[model samples]
Target chain A: MIDLKRDGDVFVLRFDAGENRFHPDFIDAVGVALDEVERTEGPGALVTVGTGKFYSNGLDLEWLGANRDRFEEYLRTVNALYARFLSLPVPTVAALNGHAFAGGAMLALAHDFAVMRTDRGYFCLPEVDLGMSFTPGMSALIQARLTAPVAHEAMLTGRRYTAAEAQAAGIVARTAAEDQVLPAALELAASLAPKDGKVVGKIRTDMYAGTLAALRGPVF
Target chain B: MIDLKRDGDVFVLRFDAGENRFHPDFIDAVGVALDEVERTEGPGALVTVGTGKFYSNGLDLEWLGANRDRFEEYLRTVNALYARFLSLPVPTVAALNGHAFAGGAMLALAHDFAVMRTDRGYFCLPEVDLGMSFTPGMSALIQARLTAPVAHEAMLTGRRYTAAEAQAAGIVARTAAEDQVLPAALELAASLAPKDGKVVGKIRTDMYAGTLAALRGPVF
Candidate 1:
C-alpha cells in the first residue's frame, strides 16, 4: 500500500509493500498519490519513503519476464514517473530508509534532494551486472543529475555505494543515522515548502529540458 | 596577452592580462584562442587558466561604464563566449588562480570542471550588490550547474565562497594549493582528453538546452 499523509504544508508518501518493487499496481498507487499531492492547493513539498528494509528493488523482473509484450509501454511509464518527479512543482526529497537499487536508484535521483540511512543499505545501479543496457531516457536522467566522473563510475561499475560514499560522490545531498532518515528528510522538505510552486517548477523544467525531452518525447 | 600552449594532449589557454577583465580586445583574444584549439585536430582537451592575483574580474566595468550605448552589443558578445565555452567540442576545465566574480564565475561554471586555489581568493556573483540583475542567460547557466539550495544562496546573497566552501557546495569539482591549481586542472583534463569530441559536445549541448536557448536566442 502507498500511503500519503499530510503534515502541515508537507506531504509524506510512504510505500509499505515489502521491497516496494515497481509492479503495475505499485506504480499505479504511486501515480494516485502524486495526483493527490498535485491537486492540493498551497505552498507544499513531498518526501518519499518506504517501509522496512527496502525503499525499492527496482523493476518487477518476474512480471516483465512473463509479459515481454508489455516491455515498451512499461518502460515508458517508468520513465514518465522519473520525469514527473524531476519536475515536480514543489520541493521533493527521497528518504532512503534502506536499499535503493537499479531503477529504484534512478527514481531517487529524480527528486530535488535525497537523504540516505548512514549505517545500512546501499544505492546502486545494477544494470551492468544484470547484463542489461540503460535506455536512453535512463542514461539521460542519470547523466543530468550527476557530475561526469561520478556518473561514469557508477554506470560502468555497478557499485553498491554506502551512504557516506554517496554523499561524497554528490549522489545524495545528506545522510543520517538509520532511524533518523525520515525525520531529516521531512525537515529538509519543510524548509523548502514555502517556495512558490510555479517558479520552482519552471526552474526545474528549464534546467532539465534535455532529460525531459528524452524521457517524455519517445523511446528513442 | 592570451597564450595557448600545448602540453601533450592538453591545450592550456592562459589569460595573462591584469585582472583579465572582459574588455572588447580581451574577448577577441580569447575567441581567437578558442578557435585555434578547435581548429587543431587530435584526441585532446582544453584547460583555461589565469596568472597573477585574479582569474577574472568579469566585465570591464570601466569600459562598459564609459560606453553605455554599446551595452547591448557588448553583452551579446560576452554571452556568446559563455555559450561557446559551454559547448566546447572537447572536455574543458577552468583553473581559477584567484577571484572569479560575476561573469567570470559564470565562465568557470561553463566548463566541464573547475579547480580553484584553496588558501586564497573567492568565487562570487556580485550582480545583486552591484545594483544589477542577471540576464536570463547568466541565471540559467548558474541554475543548471549548481543545486537549488547552493544556487539560491549564491545568487541572492552574492556570497564570496572560499575554495573549501565552493567544493563542499558543489560549485567546483576540486581545490588545490595556489601553485597546484593549473597542474591539477591539466591532469583532470588529460584524463578525459581521449573522449570523442562530437559525442561530448552533443551531450553538453543537449543537456544544457534551456541555458543555450536563453544564451543564443535573444537579449530578453
Candidate 2:
C-alpha cells in the first residue's frame, strides 16, 4: 500500500506494504499519488519513504512469473514511472529507511536527491549476478544519475553499497540514522520546495533529455 | 601541435600548442595521434596531457569567429571526437597539467579517468556566463559522466572548480603536484593496459549507449 500525506509544503509518500515490490496495483497506486502531488499548487516538493526493513525490493518476481506474457508491457510501465519521477515538476527526494535493490534503487535515483538510513540495509543492483542485463533505459538512468566510475563498478560488479559507501560513491546525497532518514529528506525537500516548479521541471527535462528519451523507448 | 610518444604500455599524447584550443587543424592533429593509439596492438592505454598553464582552453574562439558557417559542422566533429574517446578500446586518462575549461573540461570527461594538477589551474564550464548553451551531444556527455547534482550545478552556475573541489565533485579520479600530473595519469593507464581492449570498449559502448547515440547524432 502507498500513503501520500501533506506535511507543510512537502508531500510525503510512504510505501507500507511488505517489500514494496512493483506489482501492477502497487504501481497504479503510486501513479495516482504522483498525480495528486503534481496537481498541488505553488511551492511544493515530494519525499518518498518506506516502512519496516525494506524500502523496496524492486520488481515483483512472483507476479512476473505468473504473468510472463506481460513482461515487456510491465517493464514499459515501470520505466515510465522512472521517467516521471526524473522529470517531475516539483523537487523530489527518496528517504531510504531500508533496503533499496535493483529497480527499487533505481527508483530512488530517479529523484532529485535521496537520504538513506545509515544503520542498516543496502543499495544494490544485482542484475549482473542474476544473469541479466539492464534495459537501455535503465542503463541510461543509472549512468545519468551517477559518476562514470561508480556507475561502471556498480553495474558490472552488482555491488551492494552501504549508506556511507553510497554517499561516497555519489549514489545518495546524504545519510542519517534509522530514525532520521525521513526527517532529513523532508528538511532537504522543504528547503527546495520554494523554487519555481516550472523552472525546476524545465531544467531537469533539458538536463536529462537523453535519459527521458531512453526511458520512454521500447523495453527490448 | 600534438606529440605522441610510447611510454611503456601507455601512449602519452601531449597537446603542445599554447591554450590547446580545438581549431580544425588541432582536431585533425589529435585525430591522427588517436589513430596511432588505436593501431597499437597488445597491452596498451592512453594518457592525454598538455604543457604549462593550459591542459586546454577549449574552443578556438578566434577560429570560430572567422568561420561562422562551419559552426555546426565543427561541433559535429568535436562531438564525434568525444564519442571516440568515450568508447576507446583501451583505457584512457586525461592528465590536467593546468586549466581545463568548457569543451576542454568535457574532453577530459570523455576519458576513462582523469588526474588534475593540484597546485594550479581550474576546471570550468563558462558557457552559461557567456550566454551560450551546450549542444545536445555535449549535454549528454556531461550529464552521463557526472553525478546529477554536480552536473546540474556545474552546467547551470558555470562554476570554476579547483582540483580538490573537482575531485570531491567526482570530476577527476586523482590530483597531483603540477610536475606529477602526467606521471600519475600514465601510471594509472599503464596499470589498466592489460585489460582486453575489446571487452573494455564493448562495456563502455554498452554502458554509454545513449550518450554515444546522442554524440553520433545531429549536432543541433
Candidate 3:
C-alpha cells in the first residue's frame, strides 16, 4: 500500500511492507507522490519513505518467479511509477527507511537526493539472477547518475550492502540515525524548497537528459 | 579511422587518432568494436582505447564548437554509438589512453569497466560549461552509473579530475602508466574472457541488473 502526506512544503511518500506481502508497483506510488507534491504543495521539494522494515525488497521474487505471466506487467507498472517521479518538476529526497532491494533501489535513485538510514538498512538488485536484462530505460537512469566501476560492480554482482557501504559508493546522500531519516529529509526538502524553482528544475531536467543519452547510446 | 583488429580471443578496439584528428563520431566507432567483439569473439568482454595522448579531448572542441549544424549530427551519431555499446550482448572494457574529457568521459562510462591512466589522465563531462547541457542520453548514462553529487559536480561545474582522483572517486578501474593502459586492459580482458560465455554473461548481466536494483533501484 502507499501513503502520502504533507507537512508545510515537504510532502512525504511512504509505503507498507508486510510479512510475505511485497509488490513492485509501489515504485509507481512514488510517482503518485511526486504528482501530489507538485499539484498540492506547489513547486517544492518532497521526501520518500517506507513504513516499518524496508524501503522495499523489489520484485517479490518468490511470487514473481512462480507467477511469471505478470512479469511484463510488473515491469511496465514499475517503469511508469519511476517515469512519473523523474518527470516531476521539483526536487525530491528519498529517505530510505530500511533495506531497498532491486526495484526498491531504482525508486531511491529516482529522487533528486537520498538520505539513507544507518540502522539495518541496506541495498541490492538481483534481477540478473533471474535471467532478464535491465531495460534500456533503467540503464539510462543509473548509468547517468552513478560512477563506472561502482555502477558496474553493483550491477554485475547484484551484491547487497549496508547503508555505510552505499554511502561510500557515493549514492546515499547522508547516513542518519534511524530516527533522523524523515527529519533529515524534511530539512533537506525545506532547504531546497526556497531555492529558485525554475533553475532547480532546469538543472535537474538537463542533467537527466544528458546522461540518458550516454546509457542508451552504444550497446545497452 | 577506427582500428578493429584481433589478438587471440581479445579483440583490440582503438581510437585511430590519425594525424591527431578525431571524428566526432568516435563514439560509434567504439560501438562497431563492441559488435565485432560480440560477433566474432562471442558474448564476453572487450577493451576500448585511444591511440594518442587522449582517450578523447572531445569534439575536437575547436572543430565541433565551430561547426554548429554538424554538431547536432555528431551528437546523434555518438548517441547511437553509446547506445549500441550499452545494448551489446557482453560486458565491455575501456582503456583510457590519457585524458577522457567531455564526451570522452561519457564514453568511458559506457563500458562495463574502465582502466584509466592515473598520472596524466583525467575525466569530466563539461558540456554545461559550453553553454549547453549534455543531451538527455549523456546525462542519464552518467546518472545511472555514477553517484549524484559526483555526476552533477562534473556535469554542472564541468570540472576535470586527475586519474588518481578519478580512481578515488571510483571512475577508472585501475590507473597505470599511460603505456601500461592497453596492457592492463588486455590482461583484464583476457582474464575476463574464456569464462563460461553463458555463465559469465549471466553473472555480468545479473551483476548489473540485480546490483542496480539492490543498490539504487530503477530510476535515473
* Candidate 2 ranges with C-alpha deviation above 4 Å: B1-138, B144-149, B152-163, B170-220
Please, what is the whole-model Cα lDDT of each candidate in the order they appear? 0.88, 0.91, 0.68
Q: Work out the TM-score per prediction.
A: 0.65, 0.61, 0.56
Candidate 1 residue lDDT tens string, B47-133 = 999888889989999999999999988888888999999998989999999999998999999999999999999999876556465
TM-score for chain B considered on its own, for each of the candidates: 0.98, 0.99, 0.80
Residue-level lDDT tens digits of model 1 in A124-186: 998998998787989999987877788988999999999999998889988999889999999
Over 4 Å off in model 3, which ranges? A1-11, A18-45, A51-53, A87-91, A123-130, A143-170, A192-220, B1-43, B47-88, B95-111, B117-162, B165-171, B177-220
Candidate 1 - CAPRI tier? Answer: incorrect
Would you list the clashing residue pairs of candidate 2? Answer: none
DockQ for model 1 equals 0.11
Predicted complexes: DockQ each: 0.11, 0.16, 0.16
Model 1 misplacement above 4 A: B1-162, B167-214, B218-220
Candidate number with the higher lDDT (2 or 3):
2
Rank candidates by lDDT, best first. 2, 1, 3
